[model samples]
Target: MGTMFYGDDSTALHFEDRALAHLKVVIATKLRRGESFTISWVHGPGEQRGRSTVWISPSIPLRFVFDDPEPTTLNPRYLDQLATSANSSGGIQLIDEDPVP
Candidate 1:
């Protein structure tokens, strides 16, 4: 699993490594262009099992961490979907996709 650390404090969101990798790209692109949006996700299997959403902006500190050192080659189709969501009023919603072969 990978963790996305948001803000200056302990607001960290976790996702499967692959999904988070794709999300990181979409998020960085939006923030780089000074866009603010909301991101929502379904919670994982645990005490946090539910849905959570957050408002993301360039002013906040965001960090993306991958568990493995080797980089993941992202799927272009998934990237397009993610970017579409990021550009939407609903903002970025992470949908986990298998690696493109």
Candidate 2:
């Protein structure tokens, strides 16, 4: 598992390592371009049944922590999906990866 510590509040949002890596790339790219956006995800097991969203901006303090120690190989398709959603009016909505056959 990996964690994204966002903003001064340091709210931790958990995600799988691979997914988080891809998100890091997309988010960094956006922030580098001076863009601020929102990202949301559905709650996982053992948490509340609703979804959560956060505003992401270059001014905010953000950190990504991975448990694997080694960096993950990012999937371009997933990155594309995330980037597409990030540009949307609704902002980024984290979606599950396609199941491997």
Which of the numbered candidates is closest to the native, going by highest TM-score?
2
Model 1: residues with Cα > 4 Å off, grouped in runs: 98-101
TM-score of 2: 0.92
Q: How accurate locally is residue 62 in candidate 1, as Cα lDDT from 0 to 100?
A: 91
Q: Note each model's CA RMSD in angstroms.
A: 1.4, 1.5
> Which residue pairs overlap in candidate 2's backbone?
none
> If scored against the real structure, what TM-score would every candidate get?
0.91, 0.92
Model 2, 1-98: lDDT tens digits are: 89999975458899988889888998999999999999999998988899998999899899999999988766778888999999998898999977
The clash count for each model shown is 0, 0
Top candidate (lDDT)? 2
Report lDDT per candidate: 0.87, 0.89
